[model samples]
Target chain A: MGKHIRTVNANQAILRSTLQGRGCGECQASCQSACKTSCTVGNQVCLKEKKQ
Target chain B: MIHKFIFDDTRMVFDVHSGALHIVDELIWDLLEAYGALPEEELAQSLSGKYLEEDISEALEEIKELTDKNILFSPDPLGGAYKPPGESVVKALCLHLAHDCNLSCRYCFAGQGKFGGAPGLMTAEVGRKALEFLVNSSGERHHLEVDFFGGEPLLNFDVLRMLVDYGRSLGREKGKEIKFTVTTNAILLDGRIGDFLNKNDISVILSIDGRQGVHDAMRPFRDRKGSYDVVVKNIKSFLESRDYRDYYVRGTYTALNTDFSCDVEHLASLGFDNISLEPVVAGEKDHYSLRDSMFSQISSEYEKLTRSILKMTKEGRHINFFHFNIDFEGGPCLPKRMSGCGAGHQYLAVDPPGTLYPCHQFVGREEFVLGDVFTGVRRGDLTRLFRNSHLYRKEGCGQCWAKFHCSGGCHANAVIHNGSIEKPYSPGCLLAKKRLECAMYLAQWKNAPDKS
Candidate 1:
């Protein structure tokens, strides 16, 4: 009951322990999410996404 | 800004700007809901009915500590300070090699692959000019990508082969590394094509709409013959030839098959590791188009898919479902996160005749045509228009909790549905938010202590 907050990133506490260094770049748009696999660079929103 | 929610038994809060997540207990969760609106004593008074004075005080202390660390209620890092990159260089091009396709799928968005244009194939000369344009427009960027698209790129196999070779030589001469990818229905994929793809290190995107029955119903040939058998067989053999590397199967879910998770599971069961099944974009008049009424069903399917992915991961048979692939820690850099896909800016699409558009979806629309490969992007006004279309500039995105994750959604979808890029398609918005929730929830489960 006393423990109330768990941080997920480097800002404070370790929030996503298993996801610490995982995930692609900060996806800014839904290009990847919209067509993801198929559209590859169809929209070219997030530069860091793995090249299709 | 902070977004908080409860999934299963865990309560989590996400700081949008800093991209931080917090798991809080019930007391802290409730306190956060009222934290900013009232004074500390007033907040405690409001929650006194449920918690003791000592407990309320301790929870308040925890909240204070977290807030002081800037982990919660973080300020917008781009508050009027974000400046667009000084120069936008072309990085990727979707080259529509052939306007004519062998399949006439009912849900074909490109008007049966011709994209509302006359059936034609891109000549070798046009293909060469397109590659040269990309190389010249790329500026100082070392690595570039070119995707061979069409009614079917394989239909123009000879020209595509020559272009790939020419692109390789051009890359070596210009000090650029060009990566190639081709998206096809797989009707024409054979051993030779597969071998060429592998040798060229070109990635492949195979189109198959899940199970044989479902795929056959949606994607059929010009003769109305089901292409499921041929497509799957070709894909299987192609995967075998390439040793199953750098490829993914992409599908579209329409009103015809709202239970799309089954399709995802079907592909997984078929031994395909990477897969993407997206909602079909069609006019409201189209019988197979998704409407507001169907959202609940679609959402549930997404949930089912999430659970399936989690269970599969537990068994060491994880399928890389594209939508669920969210990187909280390693997402795009800051500027890209705010700007979204660089369509019309960093990316452009070339039709068979070498006419350029912002992206593939906007190919046939004359208004979106930027210029041809010969003259380069002459429509500077259009480029500027797309360049300024950022998440913050989008209408109604300010209050959305998932705005940062989706980066204001797809511009083309918005234009098609609402007639303006600033106005988002509400259905797509709702679907994207739901997917983001599922993705975040999956992330939570994967990081949970019980995960193996």
Candidate 2:
């Protein structure tokens, strides 16, 4: 079979999964608007991947 | 459903059900569109003229392997009748310290901070009661959050300081830990206030719209004078005092500034590491509402901003754009992913007068007023309504690929525009989809094997 597709699962990334299931807990705490925290839920568990 | 998009020569596919992402070659990408419609042999036979027979067969096998692993085209995990946990606890509250604002922002969502009522500041007693209500309603949740929000919270600086101290003492006595944050316009952020926030380990969300022109245009003072100079000066000092940590330089981009990415870049250039730029939410008739015609321009701006972020990361200069900050591995759990920011249930907003609303955005709406803090969530019906507003229950989210990421979008915006929380605001949805596409593309590039 042709292995043409390359995939990266979420598990491979170096992220702190500690905030999972806390659902908008911290975001609602800091948020002032509806759209402000659209992607901020993940921000609670801050993405640490910085490719240099 | 698997969502696919191409950005800057990169083809990325997102597995909606499993929240898995894949970067595929052109062949597999096209093949995926027609997948599951027919048997493997029949599918290959139909595309024989376009692709090699052996290549088609091989790709089908690969797809089958991923599907079997439940990484691609996975079935919906919640299945049809998913019931949310019955019990709800208050985990966070947005406390409006002052209902009046110093600078009259043209895009003021809370009707210039008074929220259509007489301008007032929260008394210390009201603040104390709000905290007490949170403690009692929180049940077993030990980690509670309270945000000092307002037309301008600094206007009630005395009450805010008193409440922080009171809340901390209450937490200690109750064996709970409370985290505090404040959203301010930076107009009154002097050295003393900065020291208090830093010492208390309180996070700050400083409001500064981008470049001077764009910021002043949207956010100006009572006399119509520009606030950019004063705000920028104060924020720079505050950022340095905090050692450049635990703060967000947040802004809102309106239709007037379609090149919103430049505003983000402007903030970055000013030495602010953490930034969040959001689109303005206003009635369609408002001049700044982000009308339909401006979507493409705004979308392109997001792409440009994405590239800028990558460039900065490649060098030593690092920044955290709140919107692009996606956590792949440690994202919110399925339930949180299905039901976003538990407004009216887990999270609620308290007005200066001690009345509570679902969230900050709904503070002025009479119908959304849940109850007074003294009474503690008298409207069980409204709380249940928000608890039931899950991804599957939303009008289009069940079939949409970005459901898990956005968690059915904002309930307040939906209710304001569509008159129901079950419906999503189309304009907000459009912006979200574009941002998610860009975010996935960035994730793919960042996690690529070649980079490592």
Candidate 3:
């Protein structure tokens, strides 16, 4: 009941710019900037979850 | 790529995409790593100088075996494309019996049972319509489940009773196994109610957090009094009529109780054999919310709980922890999976007035309302959204070592935590990975047989 796919794609683009610039690079190999939790740098969980 | 982690004596590698797990010895591990970089001939040459031909070939055989399973495969730069969710039959329906709750818990996700709407109870007419909807929409699935859900389903005990009778009658006529389940706070449970539940063979999910202080601190009556004493008394009374094995003691751990293993211990001490602990879902500002800082502590507590279970298991008492019994083979196979639980696809929740929802979590949210019972289902818009919300459609799930197993985790939590269902809640995402790792560790170290 929502036109979310297009908005999601657009938001993702903006999020990518903001998060990546702030060092919160995308972790999932499946999608760009897919993880939304504020996992700080050097967090082991984020490190392990990142693409190998 | 397979993420490999080596322990003291064993090597574990997870193929996130294919949903395969590989646990090998040091030699086979070396072989797999070497093969990833070198061709078979070159790989053999590289490892041949250090090992015997037979041993190397055995390792090669292992690789070949893994290759057959797609656990080991050549990488192609060509990536995947979004595949819409296949038409899946509805096998389970959650019936929200009451929109009002007696306990106004601090972290109540449903806003104290009314969800976001005014307090109300479902009518028998609505319940009958919901049952009809489930039977109509469930396709040809011979096994169907109906869960009596609520702020406190007991609040609408009459409707629930009539619905169960109606469901049983319908099941007999249609030749479907209509299993019923109820998730309750146990406050309204009494001797007569318990007997009815057992006689009707209705499975119950009892909510009892743990020790008095902790349970009462989070969950309190509408009168602003602690509910621990009343809940425990009611739980014990309920079990007297029903077999304890037919129910699960479900608890939610908040930030206040990060050391939650003690809660499990308390439940176990009370002679409850089945237990499950879920983390509270709340905004970061909420005092009881599980924040980023508590992830490690909570994860460690789970580890402790696992150790305790192992000890109990060795002592000849087996306790059922819901996640530990997760059988991937018995679960949805790789091809049939979408991201997170198959909400809206394989499962649907019906609200008080017969409004259909994706699942119980989205019961009150207007944005997530798929449709109401009167108009059948508003399939086009919501269906396409859920169809496209598959793991493969999301670019972020690729190469995650836990992807196939986690299936990108829960959609509701993603939407709640990250402001979008398209994203992953990192804390939960990380905890799941940790849990999988723990489950794997326990299986191998305990010499547990392949339950898969």
Candidate 4:
């Protein structure tokens, strides 16, 4: 039972890393962080969070 | 899990799983808050249709990324949020060390060029308090620069030393650096004084109009004796010292000595790197105003001066035309929000008596007083001056192309000439444009081949 649980935790860790990578890769590059591009007006339209 | 919070017109989204908070773009957050009940899929499709020509699948994928970062959050009929280069960052503080002077130069702006209206020096108590106020008021993580000025800063040696020591101590305590400079007459600069200045990293700007005849004609002692010899002797000694190579001494020339071509060369030969020539401020007597002919003559003399400096610079020398040109993009000189002059906004000058004027140039007039320094720096009156002062936002100046560069000239000069700060600063603005144009012409000429 202990061995099985350890294997499941390892698989979950790998799955989490994959999801994080995909999520970060798809976000708009121009809006690195919100504060950095706040002065620009068009940066608002590029915001992906609002689209969803 | 994603959590969203909004404050101060900013939105922050936090990811519980990653312990990371991502701030959303200001505009996007505002749009989201405006459109209250849009489903994520429908919103994504609409965004794709309206803005991007890309497929909805790609847009949805991008939205998922933002959602994962916690920068985007869904509303449970509750709430959600997020979000916020450099031109010239020149910050300068003109510190008035003493309201008194030892020698009365004929054209002193501080009214100290004469003996009558000179006030006493700043006490140690006042100096300490002022330094504390300056240090505390300035935000953390910004460069602090102090420029020592007065009728003459050297006359009040005790207070100067106290202020310097205080600055050094505060710098050490806060892990911040402070730079010091002084504008003075070369008459008081001896070998010992030069050594002390070099040790303390203080740059000296000496006022010497031109050669013996011209300098003496403009800047004479109270007893009317020529001070050229004394000042020259001091300059010679200071420049000949062992550490002279490291010392920075710039010559400041007034407009009265326009006829002295030889004097300009003399200054260059005296080992001065930078030279600043300024037009004499208008006074009660019509002593300094140039006639059309005289102005032409002065312009010719300036051309010669520029040639001399350019020649030296070619031979690995450096020179600066003080009023005409400044290296705005090169270094951090003063705290200017935009690439413009500081008047009525970034900084204000307060006199020894604690009266707040727009700048150092208008310290004497009562009508120009915004408030007393003792009360003004803490209150809202300083901001009010920006709104009410004509000099701050003149209609003509606002529409002018030179607005970004000159900021409509100094507020003090405007108030003095027009009797109201709201009027256009025509004199200074016209002079500044002429000077800049002349500098540009000279620069072009320097780069051109010798036609002769």
Which of 2 and 4 is the better model by TM-score? 2
Deviating ranges (above 4 Å) for candidate 3: A1-52, B6-10, B16-20, B26-35, B38-65, B68-89, B328-330, B445-452
Q: For model 3, give the TM-score of chain B.
A: 0.88
User: Is 2 or 3 the stronger prediction by DockQ?
Assistant: 2
Sliding window of 10 residues with minimal summed lDDT for model 4 chain B: B77-86
Cα lDDT tens digits, model 3, B134-240, are 77776776667788887889989999999999998988887676778888898888887888898888888888889889999889998889999999888987886
Candidate 4 docking band: incorrect
Leading candidate by lDDT: 2
Question: CA lDDT, every prediction?
Answer: 0.79, 0.81, 0.67, 0.49
What C-alpha lDDT, on a 0 to 100 scale, does residue B430 get in candidate 3?
A: 78
Top DockQ hit? 2
Clashes of each: 13, 1, 6, 10
**What is residue B440's positional error in candidate 3, in angstroms?**
1.9
lDDT of 4 at B56: 41
Tell me the tens digit of each residue's lDDT in model 1 across B58-154.
Answer: 8888777767766678666656344676667887788999999999999988888899989999999999999999999988787788889988989
**What are the RMSD figures for all models against the true structure?**
4.0, 3.4, 11.9, 18.2
lDDT of 3 at A3: 13
Ranking by lDDT: 2, 1, 3, 4
Runs of candidate 1 exceeding 4 Å displacement: A11-52
In angstroms, how far off is A28's CA in candidate 1? 12
Q: Show where candidate 2 strays beyond 4 Å.
A: A10-52
True contacts kept of each: 0.21, 0.32, 0.00, 0.00
Task: State the displacement of the C-alpha of residue B420, model 4, in Å, after optimal TM-score superposition.
Answer: 3.7
